[model samples]
Target chain A: AQTVTQSQPEMSVQEAETVTLSCTYDTSESDYYLFWYKQPPSRQMILVIRQEAYKQQNATENRFSVNFQKAAKSFSLKISDSQLGDAAMYFCAYKIPGNQFYFGTGTSLTVIP
Target chain B: DAGVTQSPTHLIKTRGQQVTLRCSPKSGHDTVSWYQQALGQGPQFIFQYYEEEERQRGNFPDRFSGHQFPNYSSELNVNALLLGDSALYLCASSLLEGRNSPLHFGNGTRLTVT
Candidate 1:
């Protein structure tokens, strides 16, 4: 079974600052995918970023980037220049090829203006 | 293009009652997946439908069942629902052929069992 773990329950960052959310996972599969999803108060789950296990290079989308250390099974999300709109519940997820996704408990992020 | 869309944005039902939720996949998407998100928690996969059949399921009870139509739309039906079933149900869609295709999610249907 694959399990994703997000250690941070809640995080806060000042506007224009940076914050990193830690995530680790346990999986037997060699090839899989990792993802970060953000859910705002509106209740829509939006894809923040994704990383492929085989790719050594990390994935970054705008201000959102991931530090994917495959050997250590660590995938942490880094938000640079955080904005107020970034305030949401961020979830770490793992998925194998052609399988369902395993998600962590989620970390609530509050961007203080 | 329209993203994944779910019907009845919010629903309230009594315990032991039955409820059905509908989902329309995004354009060019061939797969539909259902997930349950409890309060202050991440989404948990319930099942996935492809080719009008169930391809994968998670650790959910038989009381939860689903169907997919030829057009790739799907329906999730919960029978004899329990209070624990009160949560947000999210529908996501993606292309089956793309190994790394990311899921496009709907706004989700908030189901409350009283």
Candidate 2:
């Protein structure tokens, strides 16, 4: 079974600064997908960004990017120019060819103004 | 376009009871997946429904069941609920054809068991 781990339970970043949330997973599948999801206090889960294991180049979307190290089974999310809106529970997820999705314990991100 | 939508934003049930939560998939989506997010933990996959059939399931027990309609809407049913079942239930929809289809999630139903 695949499992995702987010070591940091809580993180804080000053406004306009950058922050990185660490994530690691255990999976034997050669090809898979990694994703970072943000769940605000309202309880709505929103997709931040995603990375494909086969892609060597890290995926970036605006201020959100991922540092994906397939060999180390590490996929970290980086948020630049952090804003107050970034405060939420961030989760790292893993999925393979199958349909099931495995998620990490989550990291609560607090944007300090 | 409308994203995934779930019904009964909140619910309360007692032990030995049954609860049913509904979900409407996003436009043009044909697959619906259900997840249970316990407090302080991540969302755990319950099952995935495609073509009105259960295409895949996780390690959840048989007490957890679901149904998918022809319109791609889905429902998650839990029987003999326990206090452990108190959590947020999320519904996600995605395209089945894409190798890496991103799941659009709903606001989720907060279930409270007593």
Candidate 3:
């Protein structure tokens, strides 16, 4: 079974600052995908970024990027120039090609203004 | 395009009662998956349906069952519900083709079993 672990329960970042949320997973499969999802108070889970395990290069989407270290089984999300709107619960997820997704406990982010 | 949508945004049920949650897949999507997210916890996969059949399921017991309609809409049925069954139920839709196809999620239905 694959399991994702998010060590941080809560995180805070000042406006215009940057913050990195850490995540690690245990999986023996060589082919997989990693993702970061954001859920605001509205309760909608939005995709932030995703990384393919086979790709050595990291994935970035606007201010959101992922530092994916396949060898270490570590996938972290970095939010650059954070804004108040970034305040939400972030979850790290892992998925195999055709299997169910495994998600971390999540980290509540507070964007300090 | 209309994303995945779930009905009864909020539902309250008592112990031993049965409840049903519905989900409509996103436009052009043929696969639907259901998840349960407890308070302060991550979402746990309940099951996935494709071609109107269950393709994968999590560790949930037989008390949790589901069905997928011809239109790719799905329904999750929980019987003999317990207080621990109270959680936010999310419905996600995605293409069943490739590995990296991302899942489109609905706002989720909050289920409260008292």
Candidate 4:
């Protein structure tokens, strides 16, 4: 069985600042994947970024990026130059060797002006 | 191009009654998966459909059933709905069941079992 954990239930960041959301997971497989999903107030789940276990390079998509530490079993999402639109519930997810996705409890982010 | 699309943005049903939600996979996608997101929790996988067959399932009860059409569309039916069943039902589409595939989600249907 695989499990994902997002320690912070809530987070806040000032506009144009950087914020990091922490996440950890427990999995038996060596080869897997990690992801960060953003769900805004509209309740639409959007993929922010993804990382593969084999790749040491972190995934970056504009202001959204992930610091994936395979040995530590930690995958954290960093939002740089945060804007009001970045305020949403962010979920950290884990995909096993296969594509079975497991999500964390989620972190609700608030971008303050 | 159309992403994963689901029907009935919102629905309300009484207890013990049944409800059905529909979903159409993204263009060129062959796999459809269902997920249930409760209040203050992450989305949990209900099941996955590939080639019109159920390939995998979660820990949900038998009361939750689904059907995938040949056209790659799908429907999720929940029998004897309970208040706990109320949540945002999300439909996702992936190319194949592997690490390389990423799921594209729909807006989700907010089902309220009152």
Return the top candidate by DockQ: 3
First chain TM-score for all predictions: 0.99, 0.98, 0.99, 0.97
Candidate 3 wrongly placed segments (more than 4 Å)? none
Preferred candidate (TM-score higher): 2 or 3:
3
Model 4 lDDT tens row, A1-113:
89999999999999999999999999889888888999999988999999989999999999998888888999999999999999999999988655679999999999999
- lDDT string for model 2 (B27-69, tens) is 9999999999999999999999999999999889999999999
The digit string of per-residue lDDT tens for model 1 on A1-111 reads 788999999999999999999999999899999999999999988999999999999999999999999999999999999999999999999988888888999999999
Interface RMSD of the predictions, in order shown? Answer: 0.8, 1.0, 0.5, 1.4
lDDT per residue, candidate 3, B6-99, as tens digits? 9999999999999999999999998999999999999999999999999999999999999999999999999999999999999999999967
C-alpha TM-scores of all predictions: 0.98, 0.98, 0.99, 0.98
Task: Give me the runs in candidate 4 sitting further than 4 Å from their true place.
Answer: none
Give the deviation of candidate 3 from the true structure as CA RMSD.
Answer: 0.6
- Compute the interface RMSD for candidate 1: 0.8
Off by over 4 Å in 2: none
lDDT of 2 by residue, A27-51 (tens): 9899899999999999999999999
> lDDT value for candidate 4?
0.93
Per-residue alpha-carbon lDDT of model 1 for B17-105, expressed as tens digits? Answer: 99999999999999999999999888999999999999999889999999999999999999999999999999999988788788889
